[model samples]
Target: MRVVSLVPSLTEAIAVSAPGALAGVTDWCTHPAGLAGVVRIGGTKNPDTAAIAALRPDLVIANEEENRQPDLDALRAAGLQVLVTEIRTLDQAFAELDRVLAGCGVRSRPDWLDAAEAAWADVTPDGPPVTAVVPVWRRPWMVLGRDTFAGDLLARLGVRNLYAGHAERYPRIPLDELNAARPDLVVLPDEPYRFTRDDGPEAFPGAPAALVDGRHLTWYGPSLAEAPRSLARALRAARR
Candidate 1:
């Protein structure tokens, strides 16, 4: 089955479960580098509908985090069968993988998933919970504190996620409230915000800051294997 995967994670998902079936992938979909030479279909938020239509794929894979609805609607209008996925938490990640397998008509599941789950089970945070601000943007700024998959992942690291209490995915907040949160660590993801710690004191005033790889903290699939180890190293180095 010829398929086009628009989401980044599903590039790996389709590669692992439905190899050779992936006819195209979004530009950001880079896990299975074998697809590096595949057709470049722009990014998740902005897709090239004309280019995609020419591919004549039997299926299309998209993600809620990546694609805007208007673009997806355009695809649907073009008679493309798009499968949009939403994996906001750890369990959802596993479930979404199975969903892809089912959609591909693949009968057997991968053994690596079980191993990934087993590895997750072994993560033991090394420190007392530290409050953190996870800003996704710079101008107005947004963070992941509550009700987010990232927050859940941070919880596994034994840190109290402040945004876990926020109402929106990336809420726009003032500088004062962020200061009032009294976070021990103000974190900036490598993407979305691209935070640098050298300017931490100047940026947030009182909070200790660290720039971290957002992929490990956010990407729940193959990239997750490195998260715990990296977090362990961060904790070991965290000043008391």
Candidate 2:
């Protein structure tokens, strides 16, 4: 079965589980190292529908949040079968991954998926929950708010998002307001915006900053298996 994946996480999952099944993928699908010889449709937000349709894929995988509706509509209007997934929590991610793989003709579950579930299942928080402000973007200062997959992941790891109750899933706040929140820790992921030690921590002043892998914190694929350990280590390192 030929597949075109618009979502990076889904692309990695499909590429790893069913090698060579993908005929096309977005330019953002950067995992599994050297992904060569595949058609690069475009970016997630602005995919080239005509280029994708020309690929004649049996399935096009996408996410509700990562992809735009008009693009999905354009693909469907061109007679392409697009599978759109919604994942706001860990459970949803696992289930959606199962569904996506099944749609890709993977009858048996991948070992990595099983291991990912097991990894999260064995998690035990080392101490009380740490209150943190998670910044996904820095220029305008957007943060993870309510009903976000990243926020849910952090919650499972015993880090409570200060903006988890905010009306917006990702709200842009002023710099002064963010510092005023006075979170115990500042969690920075290196994607959407790259927040390094020198770059991000200075703004938070007294708050310790945990610099983490954005893929582990955001992507819901094979990375999930190691996210628990890697994220825990980063969080622990910040305290040390």
Residue 76 deviation, candidate 2, in Å?
Answer: 0.3
* Clashing pairs for predicted structure model 2, backbone only: none
Per-model root-mean-square deviation over C-alphas:
2.1, 0.8
List runs of model 2 lying over 4 Å from the truth.
Answer: none
TM-score of each: 0.89, 0.98
Candidate achieving the largest TM-score: 2
Runs with alpha carbons beyond 4 Å of true place in candidate 1: 34-37
- After TM-score superposition, the amount by which residue 213's alpha carbon in candidate 1 deviates from its true location, in angstroms, is 1.7
Clashes of each: 5, 0
Model 1, TM vs. native: 0.89
Candidate 2 lDDT, 1-240, residue by residue in tens = 999999999999999999989999888889988888899999999999999999999999999999999999999999999999999999999999999999999989999999999999999876888999999887788999999999988898899999999999999988888868889899989997988987665558789999999999999999999999999999999877
lDDT per residue for candidate 1 within 1-240, as digits (tens), equals 888888776777678766678778887886877774468789888889888888998888888877899988888999999888887888788788788767866678777667667777898877677777778776776677456777777778777777776677778878777657777877666875567775456446777665667777777666666677775566456444
- The CA lDDT of each predicted structure is 0.75, 0.93
